[model samples]
Target chain A: MNSQNVFMGENLQELTVHGKKEFPIQYYADELFRLPGCQFPLHWHTEIEFFAARGGSIKAQIGRLEFLLEEGDGVFVNSNVLHSFSQLRPEDRCRCPNVVFSGELIAPADHLIYQKYIGPLLSSRQLPCVILKPSIPWQNSILSCLDRLFSLMQKHALKEERRPLPLLSFDSPADDIPCWEMQVQNELNRIWQLLISHAGEIPPVNIEKGEASLQIRMQKMLAFIRSHYASPVSLDEIAASASISKSEASRCFQAYMNQPPVSYLLDFRLEKAKQLLSSTPDTVEEISRKCGFRSSGYFCRIFKRRTGASPNQYRRETT
Target chain B: MNSQNVFMGENLQELTVHGKKEFPIQYYADELFRLPGCQFPLHWHTEIEFFAARGGSIKAQIGRLEFLLEEGDGVFVNSNVLHSFSQLRPEDRCRCPNVVFSGELIAPADHLIYQKYIGPLLSSRQLPCVILKPSIPWQNSILSCLDRLFSLMQKHALKEERRPLPLLSFDSPADDIPCWEMQVQNELNRIWQLLISHAGEIPPVNIEKGEASLQIRMQKMLAFIRSHYASPVSLDEIAASASISKSEASRCFQAYMNQPPVSYLLDFRLEKAKQLLSSTPDTVEEISRKCGFRSSGYFCRIFKRRTGASPNQYRRETT
Candidate 1:
């Protein structure tokens, strides 16, 4: 595989494991082993994930907690809880990106992922969502489970060689459940099975259920801005869509997020620009266009202001 | 002493070395023994500091650079650059916090603190900001420099006790430069020299050239909300105090921050309430009032919807 493609890949939709379809989910050693220095954004998938530092250490941030993982230590993040990971250590040997896929490569419901796993994890502050240094026994068992899950995923992928359609289904319910690593494994596997058995559709987003108020309307507006951040969005258009007066929309937004809606849009665009700069060798004009800046000059100015270095200087320094 | 107060202690006015009132400069270390597991936040003081971790590993985010502090590794951050640090390995010990105070602290412009050390370090992208393990010859010298600097600062603190008044009254230019640590033992000896020379007073918050928008008005609004969240904060009142038209203020806020000003207020309040529920032993009603919720019932409904758990349930589960 081209190493550069791994870093600069844009078609995030088509990633797969072995032969079976890959959906974002729980931790597997194989996936981690497959790619080195991989990173993911702050997001939640339909499957629970445990992050472990195999060789060196990895830093995982979930909500307020930040975990610095040593070898054999792991943090189990439940489904639909926002999280991000990075490995910024020098002595690390196994620097493969750690990610697990939810079983919903066949069918998915975002809510099930959240309700069953994330809800429980979040509700139970008792179980440190951010855990480190598991007992040797527990670590070995968890590692074994991860290996088996990886093998199973590989087996499903191998089936594609024999049958272009659905692969041979495993019958035993005992076999259906992935072996227990932690108590969470059972629920995690169950949700995975559900998602796997019925994967192939986008889940509905959450709806705000409250009295019709200016604030509630504003939340919808904010969500819209987040969803359409990649595209060119306008205040009048957003105001009309959110069914509020332009002035009122602007007012409500400023009061909540601290900046004007347009300014937020600009900031978000600039953030994307910075990301592209570091991760990809995209040109200033291209980045600006992608980020919806009206002019490269404006983009450069904002970029420099936000980050002391210019876009080009930053790209050169990092890349 | 309250452990939690470690972060806010003494209002450490400026960075110093050996308590002498001079500008802060970066120190390079060749052994991890002196600087291990140095975890710090991304904040800058008047002085610029550089830290090179030797024979140990660290991970630091210096501005945009996510540095892997390998042996002989170092990263130099500009004064007031917000950054954070974490240990990379189990063996790495915590490094002491580094600071770079302003040249205006005691010395003249073009002083060694800013010119000789930081100049070369900042410009060189090839040099690792943090060293993991330094080569043989450079290690001893670097360690000695750091060790002496530490002792010098300690000595300077001692001077503060013996001579509280007229502390900066040393007459001779020769006395201005001492041979305590490194090359600038003289400047390092001016412990509280600037503060002692001038009467006790906080420097006015000046608008620095090329500084980002003060964010003063926004901060004031947020602070007001935080302090009096339980009380009513009308849009007109907030706008009047901030010196902006209510509509303009709201629009500016929304355009920049993405949420309506009101929703932001609600969310910030709710977030605090959630934290209190998790961290403190307060009752739901008490938390509700403290968090600015209209009533316990309203708080419960909103809390449940936002967090998928009741306040009591959340508290119980978290605690």
Candidate 2:
């Protein structure tokens, strides 16, 4: 698997244990170029993330909300929100600079800063993500900060290459101070302050007990789907995995995923089949069965409708 | 107030509040290019720091221990250890890449990573600083990690300048993920792990109660000196502020700073006088009095011996 793809396992609830246990900040600069009809799969992590489009336009999905970010546009994903991105045009490549860091980088839970700002935003259900449009004053401020930070990081790297290799010595200087690192830390804090202050203007998401429980159920159902995607699955089984009624499962998926349970299952199966088609030389009948499709004819019909291409064609073009 | 100079006030104890209230990770990258006799003043901060020599050689003093660091040499300063730096030669210009961050960045107080590794190393009296020389395998590994991290930071920054700005829209796709951020986080973690594992190899420092109390008293005396540096102060008053005997104060200064209390005071006064001479147009007599010198003749004598020039000549040359 490409390291660029953050998804590690079949599960949608991604436990993104970023960095090592001692260091928890994660950073990535990825150029995402997708063929038309190809979608990055949905997954969620506890780390807060910022995704900025570097070239062309891309569509980002945070929960059920969709945002179309053109070049220079960006978005912030709050912790544990289901989100993904896709290139808007088949012919255009979408390059994005993305950063994901543990909220602990902002403040520890016991600290006043965490309690006053970061805690409220993280716990709030309504502000799961914020769209950073360059046109909006506050959002534009954030984009500029992000841009400056990225540039500084680049300068630091360039300096390393241009500088001579250090010689070894046992004598450590006591007056060595890190001025650039301080600048980076200051910039990140400024960005956080902007986000925390703006979070106050947005209405709090009133999450009812029933709604909260439903979200948990949906997560459980999604996990079930991921694990059983290649096997024969049904709405009854999905609902049973979450200990919810079949109707409730279907309603929950429809509400959050904007698709019925069976439709989601079918789409997931088709996505798996498409992957198999491109990566493996399995016959259509074998691929269809392996991906939980009943027959090659039905698989072809659904794949064509969703991807605008037959399974064989997708494989040939993408491969 | 050159930004490169980390010293903010006259107090020897620097309570470096890094980042913001909500974030406390302070970072700085300072390049030290000094003429012979130029020195970064002695100071201590609660934050931990890493200093890597980029070019030439410099002398670093931490507490009573002094080390001559050649290019590529680095050192880690544990929390609250007095340290200073000076250029090794009149013609040499030393460029160092230094990083200072809160120990909290490694792990919060409640975190196991802190309790198991960071906390012990920080609170230990013996491990106030560690010299990182390329000749030592573990230290060399740490230097390599630091180099990699710096390079990665540069890459992230450069990517921003190389890419075009993003445009905004509401139709977000589901495929954009940050891969580079993850890479950075991973590298930082690797560095932390190496540090933690190697920390066990060093012996624990045994601190005596008398020595600890002497340090506290010295801090009090230093604070008093900062507050009264511009006044007609004496050794008796400085010792009285810390409720210690004058001889004891002198002994403590000699032990830790490698100078008598009065000598430290004179050097400090001369440093202040130099700053005033260059920045303000006050007459030499007035500036000498303001810096707590008894007479212009004595001040000129000390300044010439220390800085290799008379007050008027130094001001004219520097200005």
TM-score of each: 0.29, 0.50
Here, model 1's chain A TM-score works out at 0.47
Residues A118-205 of candidate 2: C-alpha lDDT, one tens digit per residue: 6777877777788788888988888877776555444452254352322211112112222333334444656776776576665454
| Residue-level lDDT for B36 in candidate 1 | 17
- Per-residue lDDT over A1-319 for candidate 1, one digit per residue giving the tens place of the 0 to 100 score: 1122222322211122312232233223322222234433333333445555555566665533456776556555654344555555544444332335443321122323334433444444333243524454444444544445534543532333452222222222123321112112233443333222322221322323332254456545655655566677999877876788889888766654446878766766766676789888778998888877878898889889887889999899878
- Cα error of candidate 1 at position B83, Å: 74
True contacts kept of 2: 0.08
The deviation in Å at residue A34 for candidate 2 is 37
Residue A74 lDDT in candidate 1 = 58
Model 1 segments more than 4 A misplaced: A1-40, A88-99, A103-133, A136-140, A147-226, A230-268, A274-283, A305-319, B1-319
* Predicted model with the maximum TM-score: 2
lDDT of 1 by residue, B227-311 (tens): 5667777777666655767786676455434456687677767767867887888889999998778899999999898878888
Worst 10 residues of 2 chain A by lDDT: A165-174
Interface RMSD for all numbered candidates: 30.8, 11.5
